[model samples]
Target: MGPEWIVVGIIAVAVLFGAKKIPDIARNVGRAQG
Candidate 1:
């Protein structure tokens, strides 16, 4: 259930945000994590 929900959430995010901006968003998230 947990992993499936995570996959679904990722798909939802990709659909909502579009593929082009994903890398940049991920980079920003990585920076925030650090």
Candidate 2:
């Protein structure tokens, strides 16, 4: 994929996952994995 596609994907992830919720999910997943 191109850089444009990467940007779009990032925007899509931010919208779908959300800025506030993503960090919490990441932290939870990190804790579980670690």
Candidate 3:
């Protein structure tokens, strides 16, 4: 794979993880409050 593809893959993984974590963090906070 080229360097460009590697960079794209890293960004994709970061985006996916960020998207997944936001909801999970909100849920955890909600549970803590309640």
Candidate 4:
């Protein structure tokens, strides 16, 4: 949709999981899928 929604989604994710853990979790998920 729009950039505002994108940003809101990001903030929601960051709040759900701390910002520091997001990158690590993403990297692990990528590696597992790849």
lDDT of 4 by residue, 1-34 (tens): 8899988987998999999999998898799999
Clashes of 4: 0
C-alpha lDDT score of every prediction, in listed order: 0.91, 0.84, 0.76, 0.91
Given candidate 2, what's the lDDT at residue 11?
Answer: 80
Give the Cα RMSD of candidate 3.
Answer: 9.3
lDDT: the better of candidates 1 and 3: 1
Q: Candidate 2 regions off by >4 Å?
A: 22-34
Every model's TM-score: 0.82, 0.53, 0.47, 0.57
For model 1, the run of ten residues with the poorest summed lDDT: 1-10
Off by over 4 Å in 3: 19-34
Evaluate residue 31 in candidate 4 and report its C-alpha lDDT on the 0 to 100 scale: 100
What is candidate 1's CA lDDT for residue 13? 87
Query: Alpha carbon lDDT of residue 5, candidate 1?
Result: 98
User: How many residue pairs clash (N, CA or C atoms closer than 3 angstroms) in each of the candidate models, in the order given?
Assistant: 0, 0, 0, 0
The candidate that achieves the highest lDDT relative to the unseen native structure = 1
- Tens-place lDDT per residue, model 1, 1-34, is 7799988987998999998988998999999999
**Across residues 1-34, which tens digit of lDDT does each residue of candidate 2 receive?**
8899978976887799998887887688799999
Q: Which digits, one per residue and each the tens of the lDDT, describe model 3 over residues 1-34?
A: 8899978975786687786676776678799999
lDDT of the structure predicted as candidate 3: 0.76
In TM-score terms, which candidate is top?
Answer: 1
